[model samples]
Target: MSEKKKSLKITDAEWEVMRVAWTTKATTSKEVTAALNEKTEWKSTTVKTLLSRLVDKGMLGTKRTGNKFIYFPLVEERSSIEILSQELLTKVCSKKVGKVLESIINDSLLSVDDITRLETLLKEKQKTAVKEVPCNCIPGQCQCHLVS
Candidate 1:
Protein backbone atom coordinates (compact mmCIF):
# COMPACT_ATOMS: atom_id res chain seq x y z
CA MET A 1 0.00 0.00 0.00
CA SER A 2 1.06 3.59 -0.57
CA GLU A 3 2.30 5.62 2.42
CA LYS A 4 -0.77 7.82 2.22
CA LYS A 5 -2.98 4.76 2.41
CA LYS A 6 -0.93 3.24 5.24
CA SER A 7 -1.19 6.50 7.16
CA LEU A 8 -4.96 6.70 7.13
CA LYS A 9 -6.17 8.16 10.43
CA ILE A 10 -9.51 7.08 11.83
CA THR A 11 -11.93 9.48 13.50
CA ASP A 12 -13.96 8.54 16.62
CA ALA A 13 -17.10 7.77 14.60
CA GLU A 14 -15.08 5.87 12.05
CA TRP A 15 -13.50 3.88 14.91
CA GLU A 16 -16.97 2.80 16.01
CA VAL A 17 -17.74 1.55 12.48
CA MET A 18 -14.35 -0.12 12.25
CA ARG A 19 -14.89 -1.93 15.57
CA VAL A 20 -18.05 -3.49 14.15
CA ALA A 21 -16.35 -4.47 10.89
CA TRP A 22 -13.23 -5.75 12.64
CA THR A 23 -15.18 -7.88 15.02
CA THR A 24 -17.58 -9.23 12.40
CA LYS A 25 -14.77 -9.73 9.82
CA ALA A 26 -17.30 -9.45 7.00
CA THR A 27 -20.76 -7.90 7.29
CA THR A 28 -23.36 -5.94 5.40
CA SER A 29 -23.80 -2.23 6.12
CA LYS A 30 -27.21 -3.01 7.54
CA GLU A 31 -25.64 -5.48 9.98
CA VAL A 32 -23.10 -2.90 11.05
CA THR A 33 -25.82 -0.29 11.59
CA ALA A 34 -27.79 -2.78 13.66
CA ALA A 35 -24.77 -3.62 15.82
CA LEU A 36 -24.06 0.05 16.42
CA ASN A 37 -27.71 0.77 17.23
CA GLU A 38 -27.38 -1.26 20.43
CA LYS A 39 -24.85 1.22 21.81
CA THR A 40 -25.27 4.47 19.91
CA GLU A 41 -28.15 6.70 18.92
CA TRP A 42 -26.63 7.20 15.45
CA LYS A 43 -28.89 6.87 12.40
CA SER A 44 -28.20 4.29 9.71
CA THR A 45 -27.16 7.07 7.35
CA THR A 46 -24.47 8.22 9.78
CA VAL A 47 -23.06 4.68 10.08
CA LYS A 48 -23.15 4.29 6.28
CA THR A 49 -21.28 7.56 5.85
CA LEU A 50 -18.58 6.38 8.28
CA LEU A 51 -18.27 3.09 6.43
CA SER A 52 -17.90 4.87 3.08
CA ARG A 53 -15.25 7.18 4.54
CA LEU A 54 -13.35 4.16 5.92
CA VAL A 55 -13.46 2.48 2.47
CA ASP A 56 -12.27 5.69 0.81
CA LYS A 57 -9.44 5.95 3.33
CA GLY A 58 -8.34 2.36 2.48
CA MET A 59 -8.97 1.26 6.04
CA LEU A 60 -11.82 -0.98 4.88
CA GLY A 61 -12.52 -3.25 1.93
CA THR A 62 -15.95 -3.99 0.54
CA LYS A 63 -17.61 -6.57 -1.67
CA ARG A 64 -21.06 -6.47 -3.17
CA THR A 65 -23.38 -9.20 -1.90
CA GLY A 66 -26.80 -9.03 -3.50
CA ASN A 67 -27.99 -5.43 -3.11
CA LYS A 68 -25.76 -4.74 -0.10
CA PHE A 69 -22.05 -4.23 0.41
CA ILE A 70 -20.13 -6.47 2.83
CA TYR A 71 -17.40 -4.60 4.70
CA PHE A 72 -14.21 -5.83 6.39
CA PRO A 73 -11.22 -4.10 7.88
CA LEU A 74 -8.32 -3.69 5.46
CA VAL A 75 -6.06 -2.90 8.42
CA GLU A 76 -6.19 -4.80 11.67
CA GLU A 77 -6.87 -2.94 14.94
CA ARG A 78 -3.38 -3.55 16.41
CA SER A 79 -1.70 -2.51 13.16
CA SER A 80 -3.82 0.62 12.83
CA ILE A 81 -3.00 1.58 16.42
CA GLU A 82 0.72 1.06 15.73
CA ILE A 83 0.56 3.32 12.68
CA LEU A 84 -1.30 6.01 14.63
CA SER A 85 1.18 5.75 17.49
CA GLN A 86 4.11 6.13 15.09
CA GLU A 87 2.44 9.12 13.48
CA LEU A 88 1.94 10.70 16.90
CA LEU A 89 5.60 10.09 17.78
CA THR A 90 6.70 11.65 14.48
CA LYS A 91 4.94 14.88 15.45
CA VAL A 92 6.88 15.13 18.70
CA CYS A 93 10.53 15.82 19.37
CA SER A 94 12.42 12.57 18.90
CA LYS A 95 14.50 13.13 22.02
CA LYS A 96 11.38 13.40 24.14
CA VAL A 97 10.00 10.01 23.20
CA GLY A 98 10.97 8.52 26.53
CA LYS A 99 9.35 11.38 28.40
CA VAL A 100 6.19 11.05 26.35
CA LEU A 101 6.09 7.32 26.87
CA GLU A 102 6.63 7.81 30.59
CA SER A 103 3.77 10.28 30.69
CA ILE A 104 1.51 7.78 28.93
CA ILE A 105 2.48 4.99 31.28
CA ASN A 106 1.90 7.22 34.27
CA ASP A 107 -1.55 8.20 33.09
CA SER A 108 -2.61 4.71 32.05
CA LEU A 109 -3.96 2.01 34.35
CA LEU A 110 -1.38 -0.64 33.64
CA SER A 111 -1.41 -3.84 35.65
CA VAL A 112 1.72 -5.20 37.26
CA ASP A 113 1.99 -7.86 34.57
CA ASP A 114 1.60 -5.20 31.91
CA ILE A 115 4.35 -3.10 33.47
CA THR A 116 6.66 -6.10 33.68
CA ARG A 117 6.02 -6.97 30.05
CA LEU A 118 6.61 -3.37 29.05
CA GLU A 119 9.86 -3.31 31.00
CA THR A 120 11.03 -6.46 29.24
CA LEU A 121 10.05 -4.99 25.88
CA LEU A 122 11.96 -1.83 26.68
CA LYS A 123 15.04 -3.85 27.55
CA GLU A 124 14.78 -5.75 24.27
CA LYS A 125 14.30 -2.52 22.34
CA GLN A 126 17.31 -0.94 24.02
CA LYS A 127 19.55 -3.69 22.68
CA THR A 128 18.66 -2.83 19.06
CA ALA A 129 18.14 0.93 19.32
CA VAL A 130 20.64 3.06 17.47
CA LYS A 131 23.03 5.28 19.45
CA GLU A 132 21.62 8.26 17.65
CA VAL A 133 18.39 8.70 15.76
CA PRO A 134 18.24 11.15 12.87
CA CYS A 135 15.43 13.66 12.65
CA ASN A 136 13.06 13.38 9.72
CA CYS A 137 11.12 16.52 10.43
CA ILE A 138 10.66 19.38 7.95
CA PRO A 139 12.96 22.36 8.37
CA GLY A 140 11.87 24.72 11.19
CA GLN A 141 9.22 22.24 12.34
CA CYS A 142 11.34 20.83 15.18
CA GLN A 143 14.29 21.89 17.34
CA CYS A 144 16.37 18.75 16.71
CA HIS A 145 18.85 20.64 14.53
CA LEU A 146 19.42 23.18 17.28
CA VAL A 147 20.28 20.50 19.85
CA SER A 148 23.88 20.39 18.58
Candidate 2:
Protein backbone atom coordinates (compact mmCIF):
# COMPACT_ATOMS: atom_id res chain seq x y z
CA MET A 1 0.00 0.00 0.00
CA SER A 2 1.17 3.55 -0.77
CA GLU A 3 1.98 5.76 2.23
CA LYS A 4 1.03 9.37 2.76
CA LYS A 5 3.63 11.26 4.79
CA LYS A 6 1.60 14.35 5.69
CA SER A 7 0.78 14.78 9.37
CA LEU A 8 -2.66 16.03 10.38
CA LYS A 9 -3.22 17.78 13.71
CA ILE A 10 -6.39 16.42 15.29
CA THR A 11 -8.56 18.78 17.29
CA ASP A 12 -10.32 17.64 20.49
CA ALA A 13 -13.56 16.87 18.70
CA GLU A 14 -11.68 15.31 15.80
CA TRP A 15 -9.91 12.91 18.15
CA GLU A 16 -13.23 11.43 19.23
CA VAL A 17 -14.21 10.94 15.61
CA MET A 18 -10.80 9.41 14.86
CA ARG A 19 -11.20 6.82 17.61
CA VAL A 20 -14.35 5.55 15.98
CA ALA A 21 -12.87 5.52 12.49
CA TRP A 22 -9.67 3.79 13.56
CA THR A 23 -11.49 1.12 15.53
CA THR A 24 -14.13 0.42 12.90
CA LYS A 25 -11.73 0.23 9.93
CA ALA A 26 -14.31 1.63 7.50
CA THR A 27 -17.48 3.08 9.01
CA THR A 28 -20.38 4.97 7.52
CA SER A 29 -21.00 8.55 8.65
CA LYS A 30 -24.46 7.63 9.91
CA GLU A 31 -23.03 4.76 11.95
CA VAL A 32 -20.39 7.07 13.45
CA THR A 33 -23.04 9.66 14.38
CA ALA A 34 -25.18 7.04 16.10
CA ALA A 35 -22.19 5.62 17.95
CA LEU A 36 -20.89 8.96 19.27
CA ASN A 37 -24.24 10.80 19.70
CA GLU A 38 -24.76 10.05 23.39
CA LYS A 39 -21.16 10.48 24.45
CA THR A 40 -20.41 13.74 22.61
CA GLU A 41 -23.92 15.22 22.64
CA TRP A 42 -23.38 15.99 18.98
CA LYS A 43 -26.04 15.85 16.33
CA SER A 44 -25.73 13.90 13.07
CA THR A 45 -24.89 17.15 11.30
CA THR A 46 -22.03 17.82 13.68
CA VAL A 47 -20.65 14.35 13.05
CA LYS A 48 -20.93 14.86 9.30
CA THR A 49 -19.09 18.15 9.59
CA LEU A 50 -16.34 16.52 11.62
CA LEU A 51 -15.99 13.77 9.01
CA SER A 52 -15.79 16.32 6.19
CA ARG A 53 -13.19 18.33 8.05
CA LEU A 54 -11.09 15.25 8.80
CA VAL A 55 -11.22 14.27 5.12
CA ASP A 56 -10.14 17.79 4.11
CA LYS A 57 -7.28 17.66 6.59
CA GLY A 58 -6.08 14.40 4.90
CA MET A 59 -6.36 12.40 8.13
CA LEU A 60 -9.29 10.40 6.76
CA GLY A 61 -10.40 9.07 3.39
CA THR A 62 -14.06 8.72 2.42
CA LYS A 63 -15.48 6.24 -0.03
CA ARG A 64 -18.99 6.36 -1.40
CA THR A 65 -21.13 3.57 -0.01
CA GLY A 66 -24.57 3.78 -1.56
CA ASN A 67 -25.68 7.37 -0.85
CA LYS A 68 -23.47 7.68 2.27
CA PHE A 69 -19.72 7.94 2.82
CA ILE A 70 -17.64 5.30 4.60
CA TYR A 71 -14.60 6.76 6.42
CA PHE A 72 -11.21 5.13 7.02
CA PRO A 73 -8.10 6.45 8.72
CA LEU A 74 -5.40 7.43 6.22
CA VAL A 75 -2.96 7.88 9.08
CA GLU A 76 -2.33 5.06 11.53
CA GLU A 77 -2.34 5.78 15.28
CA ARG A 78 1.33 4.80 15.78
CA SER A 79 2.40 6.99 12.85
CA SER A 80 0.53 9.93 14.36
CA ILE A 81 2.20 9.39 17.74
CA GLU A 82 5.67 9.27 16.16
CA ILE A 83 5.02 12.46 14.18
CA LEU A 84 3.74 14.34 17.22
CA SER A 85 6.56 13.08 19.43
CA GLN A 86 9.20 14.18 16.91
CA GLU A 87 7.57 17.58 16.56
CA LEU A 88 7.42 18.02 20.33
CA LEU A 89 11.04 16.93 20.78
CA THR A 90 12.21 19.37 18.10
CA LYS A 91 10.33 22.24 19.77
CA VAL A 92 11.71 21.43 23.23
CA CYS A 93 15.41 21.53 24.14
CA SER A 94 17.38 18.26 23.86
CA LYS A 95 18.32 18.58 27.55
CA LYS A 96 14.61 18.56 28.36
CA VAL A 97 14.00 15.02 26.98
CA GLY A 98 15.25 13.48 30.21
CA LYS A 99 13.13 15.87 32.28
CA VAL A 100 10.10 15.01 30.14
CA LEU A 101 10.74 11.27 30.54
CA GLU A 102 11.14 11.63 34.31
CA SER A 103 7.90 13.59 34.58
CA ILE A 104 6.02 11.02 32.47
CA ILE A 105 7.40 8.07 34.44
CA ASN A 106 6.58 9.77 37.75
CA ASP A 107 3.04 10.71 36.70
CA SER A 108 2.21 7.33 35.18
CA LEU A 109 1.33 4.30 37.29
CA LEU A 110 3.21 1.28 35.94
CA SER A 111 3.10 -2.30 37.11
CA VAL A 112 6.36 -4.00 38.16
CA ASP A 113 6.40 -5.90 34.86
CA ASP A 114 6.01 -2.69 32.91
CA ILE A 115 8.87 -1.09 34.79
CA THR A 116 11.05 -4.14 34.17
CA ARG A 117 10.19 -4.11 30.47
CA LEU A 118 11.10 -0.44 30.15
CA GLU A 119 14.35 -0.96 32.02
CA THR A 120 15.27 -3.83 29.69
CA LEU A 121 14.54 -1.65 26.65
CA LEU A 122 16.74 1.14 28.05
CA LYS A 123 19.62 -1.27 28.70
CA GLU A 124 19.30 -2.69 25.18
CA LYS A 125 19.40 0.80 23.63
CA GLN A 126 22.52 1.67 25.64
CA LYS A 127 24.23 -1.50 24.53
CA THR A 128 23.33 -1.12 20.82
CA ALA A 129 24.26 2.52 20.28
CA VAL A 130 27.77 3.11 18.88
CA LYS A 131 30.16 5.99 19.56
CA GLU A 132 28.71 9.47 19.98
CA VAL A 133 27.20 10.95 16.82
CA PRO A 134 26.96 14.66 16.03
CA CYS A 135 23.52 16.24 16.15
CA ASN A 136 22.19 17.23 12.71
CA CYS A 137 20.55 20.44 13.90
CA ILE A 138 21.54 23.81 12.48
CA PRO A 139 24.13 25.64 14.64
CA GLY A 140 21.92 28.47 15.96
CA GLN A 141 18.62 26.58 16.27
CA CYS A 142 19.71 24.19 19.03
CA GLN A 143 22.65 23.59 21.37
CA CYS A 144 22.74 19.92 20.33
CA HIS A 145 25.87 20.34 18.22
CA LEU A 146 27.67 22.63 20.68
CA VAL A 147 30.84 21.33 22.35
CA SER A 148 31.50 21.99 26.01
- Could you give me the TM-score of model 1 versus the true structure? 0.77
TM-scores, in order shown?
0.77, 0.72
Question: Per-residue CA lDDT of candidate 1, range 1-148, in tens?
Answer: 1134346467878888888888999987788889988788788888889889999999899999778888988888898788778877766767678788999988999999998999999999999998877666666877886766
lDDT of 1 at 120: 99
Clashing residue pairs in candidate 1 are none
Residue 108 lDDT, candidate 1, scale 0-100: 100
- Candidate 2 regions off by >4 Å? 1-6, 128-148
Please report, in order, the local distance difference test score of every candidate based on alpha carbons: 0.82, 0.80
Model 2: per-residue lDDT, tens digit, 79-120? 777887766555555556667778879999999999999999
Candidate 2: clashing pairs of residues? none
